[model samples]
Target: METILDKIIAKKREDIRNMTELTINDLDLSREKRSFIEKLRHTSEMAIISEFKRASPSKGIINANLNPAEQGALYESYGASAISVLTDVYFKGTFEDLKTVREAVNLPILCKDFMVERKQISHAKAAGADLILLIAAVHGKDALKELHEYAAELGLEVLVEIHDDEELEKAVSIGAELIGINNRNLKTFEVNLGTTEKLGPLVRQSGAFLISESGMKTREDVVRAAKAGANGILVGETFMSADNLKQTFRDFKVPLTVPQR
Candidate 1:
């Protein structure tokens, strides 16, 4: 019995395979893809790429009408390093979500979707996406390598997401500059913050920028991740699901008291 994740991923793979009929090489490239990569490279601050995720498998709809654009604008105003928009429609997001963030903020907007082929690349590029995520677990090494090269050619920065060593090695081998270490096992949706603490260093050693994803609910988690050499943190559920989203995000930055040193 294939789970919802399995079904969605399979359908996506088929869509990508079907995309061959359109002749990917002949498809025109959008200018926004190149511009988006420029903005991300310029935001040198070590800050959160705050995500506006509506729902997740572990928790039901957190905010059905949260208005991603408005929320993203607010996040940018509050000093978010960047914005993350989930473009997986079945999981509570779409290209519109990416556009919403794009229109509302000057900060970079990363399209958090299961990108399989180049067609979606043009879609995301046209929709105002500044960056695109390419999950290593979903694609074979060859496919990821091809997509990564294509994305670079399109002028989009690729966030190569890896869950473990196998994928991490592949990500490094492909010369990915941005590495996202996802703590959640998409196969079972089980999260272990330790994954970030565990693999982040090895990824950094390979020369890619590092980020910690999932299982982060508190400032301690942020500090722990930062100590692990994470260049940035991608936070969504804890902030968006809180009763007071603004305050929850703010609390992560409250200064810790120290005995007179």
Candidate 2:
């Protein structure tokens, strides 16, 4: 059965074919690169990576009127470790959103998209993104290795996202220093915080920076993730829908009880 991920990847392939070539010179390499992992490592609290997202396949039209620049600034002022901007068409996002956020905030920006090719990474870097997301379920091991290496060569951090133990093994095998355990399964769109409970220890024991992604809402959710061994948490809908952005962000900044190995 074809899942939403399949549709997104299919659309990405089509978009990739139409994209123009972008070289290293086309990007602003002189801009100081902020380390996303370093921020997580040094933080005593569960690092919050706030997202500037407009929509998603499961929950469409989250906040269509959201201004990326303003939201990015808010996240920064509220002590977000980093800012993530959705750059996928299906999500009603564009690379322009990322550029706008980059111009507004000094925080490390993650270009949240269904990245398949190196060209996409080039586009991300050109748009002022310091990091890119590579879903483990999207590519074969060899293909993922190539993309990871290519992103490193371009001076961008790769957040390798995984759903299960199989994907986690693949991420580990590739020497991925930043591993994101997404509670929401991309194929089924089902969310379970237990996914983090099951995978977090393994990721932490591997000595990688473990991040619990998706379905994080209240302070309890943040605590659960932290206790499960997450150095950071990637939050989107909760922040987007919050009436008081600053308070909500601050509330989620719970301390990590688990020691980092």
Candidate 3:
């Protein structure tokens, strides 16, 4: 059976083929690199990498009228440690959105997309992205390693996303320091915070910066993740649909030292 992730990857390959060459000169590489790891490492509170997501494969058309630049700035003002811009067309996003956000904020920017090619890393670096996502489920161990190294070569950090222990081991084998445990399963789109609870400790034990991604809606949810040993949380729909972005961001910024019950 073809999953949503399979369909997205298929479309992405076609998009890459049709993509026009984006030379380094064509992009504004003048922006200084903001370190995503450094920002998270130094923060006393649970770091929040707020996302500028227009939609998702499961949830469609979330705040379609949102201006990426404005949203990015708002996230910064609300104490976001970094800004993540979804750069996949399947998610109703584009690289233009990442660029716009880059121009508007100085926070570390994550280009959230299914990265399979080195050229995509080049595009991400040129667009002023500080980090790029590499999904372990989408790439073989060797491919994942190659992309992780390639991103490093371009001075961009890799947020290796893993779904299970096998994928986590693959990320660990690649010496991935930044790992995002996505709670929403890409295959079924079913979200369970327990995904983080189950995998977060292994990541923490491996001495990697653990980021819990997706399905974070409330303060309790954030607390739950923090207790699971997440150094940071990647929140999208909650922030995008928020009537009060500042409060919502603040509410979700639980202390990393949150006491376990």
Best by lDDT: 2
lDDT per residue, candidate 3, 1-261, as tens digits? Answer: 999899999989988985666655665555677898987767778999999999998988898998899899999998999999999998899889998999899899999998878889889888779999999999999999998997887778999999999999999999999999999999999999999999988898888999999999999999999989998999999999999888898798778863221
RMSD of 3: 2.5
Model 2 lDDT tens row, 71-143: 8988999999999999999889999999999999999999999999989999999999999999999999999
Using Cα atoms with residue i matched to residue i, what is each candidate's TM-score against the true structure? 0.85, 0.98, 0.95
Stronger candidate by lDDT (2 vs 3): 2
Ordering by TM-score: 2, 3, 1
Better of 1 and 3 by lDDT: 3
| TM-score: model 3 vs. ground truth | 0.95
- Which candidate gets the maximum TM-score versus the true structure? 2
The TM-score, computed over Cα atoms with residue i paired to residue i, of candidate 1 is 0.85
Off by over 4 Å in 2: none
| All candidates: CA RMSD (Å) | 4.7, 1.0, 2.5
Report the CA-based lDDT of candidate 2 relative to the real structure.
0.92
- In model 2, the clashing pairs are none
lDDT of 2 at 184: 97
- Residue 42 of model 1: what lDDT? 51
**Predictions in order: lDDT:** 0.77, 0.92, 0.90
